[model samples]
Target: MDIQQQLINAGQYLKANQLAWGTSGNLSARLDDHHALITASGTYMANLKEDDFVTFNLQTGTYEGTRKASKETPFHTGIYRVRQDAKAILHSSPFYTTLFACSSETIISELFIETMYYLEDIAYVDYYHPGTQELGDAIAEKANEANIIMMKNHGVVVFDDSISEALMRIETLEMACRMILKAKECGIKLNLIPQEVVTSFLEDSKYKPRKKKGENFQR
Candidate 1:
């Protein structure tokens, strides 16, 4: 499928999975080194049309389409500017992830195989009013350190080499967050996988062959 259709399908998937609702999230894909295809401002993720997207110039910070680009375009472009490997981004406030974002709790990625691979390098960005350059800058500073960035009192920004990978990351993060919260509520002490074991899994496991070099396991 085309990039536009991939994003449209992603939006519907996000909504159906409760990862996004109303017009609360934004999605984007790199069209080239200089431009991006991003959701238009105020468009519902679940009900997007082709025209609901704008072609944005990364260098000039201008856009063209039937509607204006998302107000959060700054950070979307900022991330693409810094991370050459990043081809897609998804920013949303899923219930459990947002609940964790609002708290001081730390996310433990050593809980399982998927968690170790996907949630291992989360970065937390302090709250900044949405759509501001300050907010964009804050997130960009940590973009290289992690694929999943938890924005305090706001939401998360996840990016990867493809839209599908980015979606998988956010879904994994939300699940990890839910597990942590549920464990705490039940007064259960979760067993963390040992650091040595985690390292071995990343290096020697069969799954290692499937991972792109320097992808997903970044510190």
Candidate 2:
């Protein structure tokens, strides 16, 4: 599918799954090294159209289209610039994910293999006013450390070489957060998988074919 359609579908999917509430989130994809396609400011993710997106130059912050880019556009562009392997980014304030973000809890448990692999070493960014250059700079500093970035008291920024991979990790992160909460409620103390086991999984050859290209590239 085309990049536009992929974004549209992603918005719809995120909305339907309750990952994006109100107009509190943004999504973007790199058009090239210098430009990106991002959702417009205040556009509802569930009701997106082609015109709801703006193509903006990363270097100059100039937008070609009539619509204004999302206020969080700087962070999106900043991430793409720093992380060349990042082809798409999904920034949303999901209930469970944001819940974990607000707390001191970390999403480092390896309750599932998918969580261990997809969300390896989730990074944290301290709270900064939304849409500010400070937040953008914070993201840039942490972009190279992990694929999923948890903005303290805000939301999360997830990126990957493809929209599919990015979305997969987004869903997985949310689900993992929910599971963590549920386990706590049930009085089940969660134990992270052993470090040795995690190391082995990381070095496992079975997942080589399924892994996306540029999955390990850092800024």
Give all TM-scores, in the order shown. 0.95, 0.93
Q: Per-residue CA lDDT of candidate 1, range 1-219, in tens?
A: 999999999999999999998999999999999999999999999999888999999998899866889999999988988888889999999999999999999999899988888876888999999999999999888887888899999999999999999999999999999999999999999999999998888778876343342333443
TM-score winner: 1
Question: For model 2, where is the 10-residue window of minimal lDDT?
Answer: 208-217
lDDT of each: 0.91, 0.87
RMSD vs true structure, all candidates: 2.2, 2.4
What would the per-residue lDDT of candidate 2 be over residues 1-219, giving only the tens digit for each residue? Answer: 899999999999999998898898999998887888999999999999989999999899788877889999878977887778899999999999999999997676477788878877688999999999999999888887887899999999999988988998999999999988898899998888997887678777466433433334453
Alpha-carbon runs more than 4 Å astray in model 2? 208-219
TM-score of 1: 0.95
lDDT for residue 13 in candidate 1, whole number 0-100: 96
